[model samples]
Target: MHEAVLGIEHPGAYSSATAGTDTTVELWCNDHCDLLHVGGSEAESVVAHVEDAVGVRERIAEGDERLLITDACLKEHGDDPIEATLAEHDCLLVPPLRYAEGRKWCRVLALDAGNLTAFYRDVSAEFPVVVDSKREVASVRADRPLLTLDSALPDLSPRQHEALLTAVEMGYYRIPRDATTAEVAGKLGVERRTFEEHLRRAENKVVAGLAQYL
Candidate 1:
């Protein structure tokens, strides 16, 4: 697999107008359309414009500073071409496409080097595409690159990790409880007391590790 950072030009995108100005718009994809996380001094102006936008829909907002926006990619308004092209090539766009100087800078996870190359060719043909970084995904060193629970709590013993994951999947942590400790224990072929022991120990480690940050 390959991971590459790309900068795509978004001409006439609502983001383009706000770029390198006062407002900063960071975007990611939902089921459909781009989700915008907005901030900066001119945030209110960006919200006002997107609220009335024909192809854009504003879902909810904490304030003008943070909002969820959906771009319908309507043809008439020159919606971004980068997304659709990436989709066709089976490349995944990493979250938070940042706007700066009229470009949408984002990271893409390509299934293979060929896919990344193909995406580059297809996208660069229409708009300027800058390859900021390119490398084998395994070559990238990050403290918690995959962002899994295990990465967050590296001190967890193997048994504790398994118990915790099973507990979560069986809804042992859910409100009103979808599953019980006994049921979880049976699934893991352990005594209910044993499962509880592992779970409690794991939970304590997690809470203690997180509490300092809070």
Candidate 2:
């Protein structure tokens, strides 16, 4: 799976917002870091939606359905307990990690809508503080360029085009945890790493080509 952008120290303690309802939640997991890894099949779509908002909550997918894991939540909780709560909600947890070694921060992946992170107030400072750095959410790279990629060729290039098209076909952006990169790449006769590189390069080219818009 791809890593989200690493923000400040801990992303949990930050105040969060949840759309939809208390049962199915979608919220922003944005933080202070600049680099972000969007690994899910719908990472692109998620990023696109995230761009409309301040953060990306999580994702969900199914076999060939490309189910959209709609509904995210921004909370004031930590990763583990929140994830555990999500599990209680029938959302599978991907992996969990402690980010900075302060024993209070980490990041993990789960079905987007199923994410239930914990939050605590950072009161050690002068005033109240909210944090969500570990969520690995990334703001749209406004610096992305779109000029290099030919509008005609946007649909070309074996590697890049194939990768993007495949993701779309699989509804990676739809959500609900569809097929994984390995799953998609395997069917396409390419390694997941190769596919990812193609996608990364394709994204860079597109960003470069579209830089003027920003």
Candidate 3:
């Protein structure tokens, strides 16, 4: 099996709310409605923008999150490229598609690398797309237990995962600290401040996820 994280420059009401802001939105949708978890300092403004977006039948806000009953599923929009391409390629999207900084991030699984590649190509034709990560995984066995590292780990954004991996590879966490934040940031082609932010978030997620075991 093959899995990948794809970042797509899709234009939508949620994307518009996240553009030029630190806000992040995670969405789960069906045929009728969408549930969104909004996070960041600007979540209130983000929810307000979503309320005014076309096709929203009704909205309920609870703290920083929102439940939206919509006329149509966002994925089923006439012009959306994801849902159709996914079906054509026989790929599956892992839920909670993420939106941040005007891009939609999706985690997709495919039977093989070829199908994943074709799916990426088709989606890229419609919108700017970036393959953030890709890997081949062992095929699942019917008798095997469900609990695993992948399931236990928290889902980190592509940038956060990249930042954490880069830091580790550069020996940022070594006893002697072979690399500094500036060095790791330079390696990743990002500002030091931005790199630090991603690394911190990644660390927090990982630590929090493992706290119970510790």
Candidate whose lDDT is highest: 3
lDDT of each: 0.69, 0.39, 0.79
In Å, residue 96's CA in model 2 sits off its true spot by 49
In angstroms, how far off is 26's CA in candidate 1? 1.9
**Mind giving the per-residue lDDT tens digits that candidate 2 earns over 2-78?**
12222223233221211111111122233332122223233344345433443433444342111222233322222
List runs of model 1 lying over 4 Å from the truth. Answer: 32-35, 54-64, 69-80, 139-214
Worst 10 contiguous positions by lDDT, candidate 3: 139-148
Q: Alpha-carbon error at 194 in model 3, in Å?
A: 9.7
Q: How high is the lDDT of residue 72 in model 1?
A: 53
lDDT of 3 by residue, 20-115 (tens): 776778888876667676765477888777666636676677543455656566655446668779989999988778888788888898988899
Candidate order by decreasing TM-score:
3, 1, 2
| Ten-residue stretch with the least lDDT total in model 2 | 15-24
Residue 115 C-alpha lDDT in model 3: 94
